[model samples]
Target: MFECFLEIAFEAEVLTEEHPELQELARQLVHEDPATRPAAIQELRDMIYERGECAPRRMDDAFLLRFLRARRFVVPRAHKQLVRYCRFLEQYPELYRDVDLWGLARVGCAYEGCMLDRPGVGRVTILRFGTWNPDDYPVEELVKVGMAMMEIGLRSPKMQVLGGTVIVDMAGITMKHVATLTPTIAYQIVCLMGLAIPCVMHSCHIVNYNWLLNTFFFLFKRFIPKKAWKMIHFHGHDLESLHQLVDPECLPPRYGGTCRHHATIGTWFNKIRKYRDESFDRDMKEFGWVIKE
Candidate 1:
């Protein structure tokens, strides 16, 4: 592994603060005697039910486990995060109101959005921003596509527990692309992603990015919650380096990696578009939420 690490050459490691103590907390949540586990879960549930005054969709033991895992299985932390997630959707319905899955897929195709075939540990995503013209599709739309992708990811049991990585390709970024990022929308996007989403973001790698990308961080870094900062990595313009961290087999040909079939942004887009069109009405509803009257 050390030799392999040197070959592609970048120092991107998963440095999340899933601390030892937190791991023990999570272990107890999952491995406690089956008899005792129910009560602990109930306690977590009551915190949500009594305080949040909302009942989110699919809050089963399995579902709650995802939250517990994300919050390091600390009941209060998980409860607070869960409440924020539900309330964000309810309060900002417009953001999700007319959820355009087809548009999302289209933009995603241009944005190079696709879940990788990483079978062992968790779901990993590679999002190529430079794949298409940002002028053709606004960055705001691209951000929404990301949100839609997260929603799509969580629908799977594996991703909910194991979480995922997001690779943002920056080769195509130009002044046109950067122009779309307003402070307000930028604030909204990160907060929505960093806080409101229930899925655990194992890590994110920013590749092929140029100097312009740093301006984004400089402008809005404060807006992002601190915990997420650790998950981000910078791998400037080097596919060889990225390939070190992510298997080349998992990447699309455009990225100087081996993945060919259904790998490009457009390929995944068409697949989703076709499926969504085939079942258009059924699948594109506003996201499910939990709120009390």
Candidate 2:
């Protein structure tokens, strides 16, 4: 996640530096009367390219690493919100694990007035949300929201999803028929995407004799992919309140090679563990993971 954030920060900075004129044009559009800005910006782009100006420089990995290191001491306010949200998840594992934690983080960060509103930072924020909950919402909704947020972050931009199929129908379809056929069609569609539905189990965690964890686990299991289930890193005081997902003795047999850590995101966490020592420790402490430093 940190690496992804750094990449976006560098991209934003590089784009701005390479295209100062474009950036100014975008600013002008924002300041102009709404009706004229769109066309004026288009005209500006054409005029610039016609003059044989060099294309903007693309963001590279080294630049991003440097930017992140430079900004290391000045943690974004949004990051603080993210840490708080992660701590919340640790405390109430059942309530937050499957509840769009990244979405909650993004909203929390936005509300907290983070510099993430700046170009590259904003893209990093979106990408983090995407990684945390790739399938939390419908694809259509994700595309719509993601595009809007990207526009806000990348100032002068066009979003295009290449090499993907899109089907558009203008025919007026009745709501009842569309609703009736949607699930069946959606099920069929998954086969085309080369995916298989995995087995899911309904389990619960009991915290303080309360069934909150169990209830949340049920909902989370429904929304998230089975393979990514272990991304929820539990912490906090009420271990007894939480429910175990699977019995150690009853572990499922794997047909192929498998690691002890099954989830991809969990694997990523392990890979970046060294780089995130401070952030990880701070998060752990905040979430009641009482470890002696």
Scored by TM-score, the top model is: 1
Error in Å for residue 196 of model 2: 15
lDDT of 1 by residue, 1-293 (tens): 64444222111111112334434433433333344556767888888777766678656775676666566556887787777777776766655566555545565445443334353314456655566586576666766666666655554444544566567777777777667678866766665454777766666778877778887566568777776788777888777877777776766676776654334444444454443322233334525321111
Residue 6 in model 2: lDDT:
42
TM-score of each: 0.72, 0.19
Highest-scoring model, lDDT: 1
Candidate 1 accuracy as TM-score: 0.72
In candidate 2, clashing pairs total 4
Off by over 4 Å in 2: 1-147, 150-213, 237-293
- lDDT per residue for candidate 2 within 1-293, as digits (tens), equals 75566444334421323333433433332232235534443443443356433232222322221111222212242123223333333333432122321232232211111122222111111011212222243433322222222222222231110001111111222332233323323332232211211111122112122223343234334444455344333323333222143222222122111112222222222233323345344433443333232
